[model samples]
Target: MAYSFPEEVLEHVFSFLRSDRDRNAVSLVCWSWYEIERWCRRRVFIGNCYAVSPEIVIRRFPKVRAVEMKGKPHFADFNLVPEGWGGYVQPWIRAMAASYPSLEEIRLKRMVVTDESLDLIARSFKHFKVLVLSSCEGFTTDGLASIAANCSNDSVARLRFSRTSNNVSTTKLLNLREIDLRESEVEDLSGHWLSHFPHNCTSLVSLNMSCLGSEVNFPALERLVGRCPNLRTLQLNRAVPLEKLPNLLHRAPQLVEFGTGAYSAEIRPDIYSNVAEAFSVCKQLRGLSGFWDVVPAYLPAMYSACAGITSLDLIYAAIQSPDLVKIISLCPHLQCLWVLDYIEDAGLEALAASCKDLQELRVFPSDPFEAEDNVALTEQGLVSVSEGCPKLQSVLYFCRQMSNAALITIARNRPEMVRFRLCIIEPQAPDYLTLEPLDTGFGAIVENCKELRRLSMSGLLTDRVFEYIGKHAKKLEMLSIAFAGDSDMGLHHVLSGCDSLRKLEIRDCPFGDKALLANAAKLETMRSLWMSSCLVSYGACKLLAQKMPRLNVEVIDERGHPNSRPENCPVEKLYIYRTVAGRRVDMPDFIWTMDKNAGSPEVL
Candidate 1:
């Protein structure tokens, strides 16, 4: 406690504290507002890039310049963290190449990133501008042609790539605009890479390679969209079918985000009146994702771009329920809807009587191995979209059965639910009209959704619904349990009450080894802990890795040595986190690391 002012008036009151949670509450209000919010911190997210230690975020943000991390653990996109289970971004670009050498942008997700850490972040940040990567993998296209011939920072605009490797040939990109290569794995996205743009390249606005498999160069992508009339956004792939999507929607009818390509063809009524008269001359289309194989007689050719569509991704549309109630009864200002549980439950009750400004919904599972008696929507179509979408604030409903009066009438009609993922696909299935346990419909969702931050639970829970989610989820930060709970005091009453629990994902249930050592000192400030198939043992994960010697504690044996088995079996899978770059030189060979006196589980 010092400065009642000065230090340039506390860096001008922490430069209007641009929320990283109000500059982490004024750097916990002390130590001179934590050295003036660490000399005016500049963008740092790091949600588990080894949960802290790029030399402790370059010694706590000394003029940090945009970092946004995240690597492997989002259950490694459901393959469940296998292949060399570690997320490396070359030790945070060799610890921010000597502390953020004025690093610019570097957003990465589900990381692994190689090509020598993108050629040491293109020779370590000389005003390196933006490098976004998502669901990343070992880098390719020779590390994106060494970040397009060494990050020539004309403040590099955008270069989005999904699931890596499309091979960016050499480099040109003058003042590069945007090149989103979605779902990549390209060996050839049809011939001569659209003649490497630049026949007077009008700074291309946006060009998404919609999961290319082949077939491109349609007159060099319509002469680079007719010499880029500031091309808005065009995502094409699925080998661009349906008769080349009405000549690329009549040359990008001034597209404002349209990603449709292979929506099947052959039934010509002049291909649904020439693709609904080329999407009624686009009228600044507001966002519609690629409709691969979608053809319910061309769903009335997108009802003339559905009243200024506001985000509709049909997750690879499988269309049913009256062609998703005639394409969600013509959008009606839809606010984010991702479908394909083949839209049953009368297509989400005609999308809650036509999209009452619905704020996000996802329903995947088209036939993810179908049958929970052929699951279609339940809980009476999720209480008729929570009694007609009172602005539903985020959902990911994958249904089979549900009830407790339809989850207490969707927690009294969507009490501003911020991300509630209800996936009752017959696991621990209960509450179907009072079979009980779903403890008060998830204790009325953390006691009336007090701004819930991500919660995913299945049915038939107990230990009084993890003791009402550890006495009313104090703004719970991510919890996903499956097959509900019962003992180990429901994971020790959510590790002695959720004080903003970072992340915990359990599988199967009945947690073991005294509920995996009842959160020994709450797993070092929680950022990760995943249990699989439950009933933990191997001497309670070697006594919770000898009482959290700064937690890394992995144990995901597929089978083979937990020291040649029988330390009371039961440890099938567990993975704890919190690493300052210790033990993770890409540990694979059946992922087992935790060796206090190496009597067991070590082998890389």
Candidate 2:
């Protein structure tokens, strides 16, 4: 079919489609469509900062105004990635400073953003409106002060930070709508910063400072809430006592999301009732979290707001089965739930009975080293939930033992599941009943759940499960394997097929360099491949790097072996990704970039 539209018309038409996926698809049609799509792109998301050089991005998409970039692999969240491991923001900032003068917003995650980077951003962009940094480090209070002073326009509505700024006495954060200072280093800011918001400003919609350590003036908070009627999400730290919770909730009854301040306080019955009454008025509550050191006695106070809630996070609360049951009973509308393993099978049964709308559930281990008998739930709980919640879509179950029957039952019951992660606390656990390999059980999942996007496999397994995954799980994008697969053939099977696979994470597996090199072609299409504690060798890694010039093959030697020879040593960790940027200069001393053109690449 011949295209009818001219270049400008096609570009304008494609501009209506906001999704990057859609734009990417259209770009593949022809050279004309690709050029139009590139020119029309106003927003861009780079999963990895180094996937493409900033110069390449500027040359390709000159109109990009909003940029969201993620640095440091996802494992960095678990502290697996060492300190000073390189997700630096300087290189990208320098590139953007020259290319994207019109860039209005930037969102960064797990990146090291220094004061210099922030200052450059503040001074570079004339219309800079938003700057968000999550799980980022290396910037101090002075950096935030620079942002506050320079980006004072009403367009700058949101700000995120960790430390308290003492010099913001005249900081004009005009029309500020959201202030998120989550998990900050400062213990006390004297709550005086609350007065910084303009007197007439009522645009605030979200305020999260759940890590603040000092007591806040209740009256000031009350006045702030009263002024900002649009406030829908509020997270208070433990410094706010239970007695003050009632007043705060009453002030913001229209809140759709809330993070309750310390639930550990011992309060009088009247005070508890006040708290309950305050919750009762919150008719729009949908998400609730933050119950630090939860007291069972105060659990009932939350009943009124539970009915409308869809997401409840109580991973930090150690409430036993009975209290959990009471809460679950009220939360019939729940679609997502996170709880400690203390909620035993009985609690799960209660959930199945009440939360028929449940779509996601995560049961985290309270004590990973607890004895077998001390564990909370097992296959029974999983089977029970599977039978009850037919709409279940995702689960992260941490248990002591599981059965093949339970897994198969779950697969058959919830065939539409998008994510299924079952972690037996004990590694390489087998079917409790048959004492056999769990290959068949996992095979059932891949065969049954055709729409599965993510799967984390555990238990005793062989190459057969990988074969099933590669052949049957066509839609699987992410696969996490740990302490299971038999040989190189296991990794080979998955890599040879599973065409849609984007990320493969393997740890403590037997697969080595042969398996890594076998999927050389497959690795280019993938976003990333992370293998740790495998039998991969340095020689094979160098060979793989030599073969795939576009791929960044990195060996992360967490064990300080700086003096170790590359050819003789085992590549304990391997991180490989296809990038427009040949090799990042910010890589740490411990990270060896093994590409053949280690220090050279043609400019894009």
Give the Å error, residue 474, model 2: 1.4
Tens digits of per-residue lDDT for model 2 on 1-604? 3278888778778878888888899999988788778888989999898788888888889988888888888767656677888888888889887888788778888888888997787667766655667777777655654554553335543444436754323222434455555543442436655654445656668777675667766676787788788899898877777778888888888999999877867668888889889989999999998888788789888888888999998886788888999899999899999998888999999999999999999999998887656645888888888899988999999888988888899999999999999888888888989999898999999999999999998888888899989889989999999898888999998998798998888888988878778789899999998888888887888788778888998888867542356564667678888898778777666787874654222121
Best model number under TM-score = 2
| TM-score between model 2 and native | 0.88
- The collision pairs in model 2 are none
lDDT score, candidate 1: 0.76
Shift of residue 594 alpha carbon in model 1, Å: 18
Highest lDDT against the true fold, candidate: 2
Model 1 alpha-carbon miss at residue 291, Å? 8.4
lDDT (Cα atoms) of all candidates against the true structure: 0.76, 0.81
